[model samples]
Target chain A: MKRFSWDEMMNRYPAFFAIILLVVALTINFILQPNMFARDTLNSNMRVFLPIILLSVGQAIVILGGGIDISVGGIVSIVNTILATQVGLNGSPEKMWTFVFVSIGAGILAGAINGFFIAFLRLQPIITTYATSFLYVGFALFILPNPGGGIPAEIANVYRNTTPLGLPLAFYVIGVVLLVWMYIRSTRYGNYLYAVGGNAEAAYETAVPVTWVLFSTYVASGFMSALAGIAITMLSGSGNAEIGVPMTLTSITAVVIGGTALSGGVGGVAGPVVGAITLGIIQNIISFSRIDTWWETFVKASIIVVALAAPGIINLLRRKKV
Target chain B: MRKFSISPPVAAILLAIVLFLLSGFLPNGYGSDINVAIAQATNIVRLAVFLGVIAAGQTLVIISGFEGIDLSAGSVVTLTAILTYVTVKGEDDKVLLALLISLVVGALIGFVNGLGITFLKISPFVMTLGMSGVVTGLIIIINHGNVSGKVAPIMTRLIARPLSPDIPIPNAIIIWIIFGFLMWLLLERSTFGKHLFAIGVNRVTAKLSGVNVTATNLAVYTLAGALAGFGGFLVVGNTGVVFIALGQPFLFPSIAAVAVGGTLLSGGKGSYWGTMAGAIVLTLITSLLTTMQMPDSVRRMVLGATLLVMISIYGRQRGFRQ
Candidate 1:
């Protein structure tokens, strides 16, 4: 039997590091804010974090599949705009639900466009998505040029106040996402995803459906981005074409902090989920610490930089010691 | 023997000309009058200089491979611009000092980025992304999210004004031409350039060939940082005022320009001349769209579609076996 070690565990599960980091961040947040675990506070925090969490999951899947979707944020904007315009503030719940499905379909179609360029035409993922992001965001702007439309207040309240079984609604959504991920992980397509990401040429040589897997990853990313858009829109009860732009980089950061390698085929959804939460907690800690308001951005950024560089620094130290 | 080809730079120039002629047909566009068109073309070229300067750094980093990218370029530009503003204090005599300070700060940021990436083994994308956050935070802390500074008179004269009474060309264009030439030489004629391309093509192979990968990477990143800083300095000169997130808009365009210039985002092959042409082409597209009186949304969609089509036509990657 092989012996377990810290390094071995980390190698086997990259999320281990993220988990430890999350625990530390949570502890600091708790110390700073005693009411952090209170139902209301937890709900608000989760609601705020949910969008990035959702975005990160999709980003993680794409990264794991050896590609990236820079257009996810744009897709989010498109969905938000679609929902805001089609299902106006006075629209009925049935109309809202109808638009929701339409939004998801739009996201999938947008993703398919990215997939076609990247998978079928073999364009670079970064550039392809970067260009398409403009298309999606532009379309959103066309739909809602002034950023004023929104869903009904009642629907917004449902997202804002909902707590099922004394837990935040976000928790349930996360649970479902995890469950679905687990099932996917158990399937052949999941194996193919890893293989393709790890080494596309090798996977192709072994008869893995490389193009399909790559295409699906982008599609999945689009789907999740749409969900994120819906969650954010409901929380804010408004639509803004530019809202999702910043979230793109934030989601990528969360995935990296979650221990996922940008090079692909490493890490999982769980790590990024925790990472997204950790990011929110870190923000909470910064806010509750009573630091000067001007220092807030700097402090948060410094923490992120340290977090990004920490693993590599530790490895360097370890190598030196060895 | 090498096969005859138009090359990316020439192709980009040709495309820019085509776009320019096409825009003439649009109502209120410059192509109706030869003098008006010449003036408009000159204005577009002036606008493109900034992007060209910034994309020069991007070209270098991309050519250095290992997934080399500098997401912090925009932030660095903002940081340096603010720093220059603070240092110059609107004094023409202090411009040189401000320039030095900006370059140093920019190089320092790049050095830190390189340290994290090369020595610490952090991915360039994550390191730069984190650094971007840190830089933004630093900016907020420095100015309390309110930027207030006047550019020196000489800077305005050089960046925004023409060279002389008879000279229709802006001094910035002349400066850009000189800078572009130097960059072209550096990439094509320098030993460092050769090492950069080799590293981008294959790190291990370059290392085995006795290339100092770490040192070279560090230098490239530092240079890139300096260029971004210089760009910031120019931006301040052109705008004559400093503001928060001033460099934000330049980020995507810089990357896009690099890609359109025919540089492979995956690295190993590229040229500054190509990037320059790309900047010109992008500027022409934006100008054309603006002249057509289209809404922002339609403009964005068209831009996105254009980039997608352009990339698909010329930027597709060869298959693995090939």
Candidate 2:
């Protein structure tokens, strides 16, 4: 039992929720068709899962560091616009790489601005991020008023065309991210992040650089946002102001699903990563179930309701035992 | 005089106006006409009043803590507005019925939000956000994505008329101020209000000290919902037509107003009066943006900056102490 709990551990983070959703997804896939687990289905499911998973991971890190970012979606919109308009600005592969750097740079710049205000200026994270969201999305609209800019044909084709042998290059990239995250979580620095978020005054008393950790978490979140934007650029084939519209809340949903406390600390990358997959599966199951598109937003929100209410239910049930 | 420390939010509002004037003084194009400037100010005040009414209710809900919020305020407006237009459909005699039904609808939704938060033990963030989505779905379903019908003509006359023609004050402002005074009395004086503040300050302590934690929370949320609904009635009069995304924009700004006005996000110490001031500050800032000849981006950037400054100043005053 201990080994089971330790190995596939984070799965137990949202134990009831993860199980319920998995059962639902599996039941839907089976009723729909037995071939639902095959290559094409897997590819499509993973594709939808990628953005949320990336966003959630970043969200988890920040929340673990005791803050929230309502600006992730706005950041994605800004970065996606950058990739759309400037992805191939230099025309050469080497120059195009520079453009990518600039896109990432934009993310860092945005994150840095957020950090300065929240960390140094002593602003509340949510309020600072909320205002910045208005600023960033408005700026994105200024840059690209409409969804007209097309990615290089080759870039769009990359996401569209699947490989028989490798499935998708995006898969490898995510796998690398997971491994790196796991490695980092084992480091002492990661331990400090938990301490900082859990109780900043205590951490400061113990000599942890609370300010730097708080600031860097946002920067780290920014990088993840940039990566997600790049992936979205490949998938959407064009840039629009609304592409990342749902991302902000979706990221939070994923993190909470992964069992990170909104009060901060007490979570890891595994929960957010799994939560993202769970969300993807839920979306896939919903799309395959003949629900209208209008109801889709409703369903996404219902999952949040269920996810939120379930914890309370559990806490209440355990109250009797206590 | 000692209490008048010159709040940063108020200062930000003043600065935005000054910037507006500097961009184009009274002798220039849009600013040349007194009636026009006053007219614009009235519209901004109208918007601010509606936002303040809902935000005042938001203050009570949040003061009970439990990760408390009432994001559904916006959706309440949407649902109530849709219902009013459908039921009244422009009749004067039936206006009271429409208003009563809307109040009931708002209260019912608020009751559900409170029940889920207190009884089910859901996080206020996710529960309210999910409810917002569900309410939004209801809005879409009822209206079929395009708003049709009209408010009662009597309501249009009584609720929409300006109280002061000299300043061209919106009738909504008059309604807002009267009700807001009632809210202040309820929150700052009543025993129910005392229980709410205690719970907000520390739910555990309040419960240990014999406060009916669940009841206070439930009542607060219910009050918030009804107030939001009533505000929607006023909104219908102001706009004279309903739009789908009408309530969507108010959610963040309401929260912003509460925070900027010096309400701690954690709850307990705040004023409905300050929230009213906060809303006016935000509206005045937005109005300044309009009077200035600057492009939309610059205008938005300034707005964002003003919000940040306001939040920071309040945080300082509250001694948020990272």
Best by lDDT: 1
Docking quality class, candidate 1: high
Interface RMSD of 2: 2.6
Give lDDT tens digits, candidate 1, residues A281-314: 8888998899998888889989988887788777
Name the top DockQ candidate: 1
Report the TM-score of the second chain of model 1 against its true counterpart. Answer: 0.96
lDDT over C-alpha atoms for residue A155 of model 2 = 54
True-structure lDDT of candidate 2: 0.76
TM-score on alpha carbons, each prediction: 0.97, 0.91
B1: Cα error in model 1, Å: 14
DockQ, per model, reads 0.84, 0.51
**Candidate 2 lDDT, B62-130, residue by residue in tens:** 677756788899989978877888888788988889889888899999999998987885667767877
Q: Model 2, which residues run further than 4 Å from truth?
A: A1-16, A88-92, A160-165, A292-296, A314-322, B1-4, B8-40, B164-169, B291-295, B317-322
Candidate 2, residue B109: how far the Cα is off, in Å: 1.8
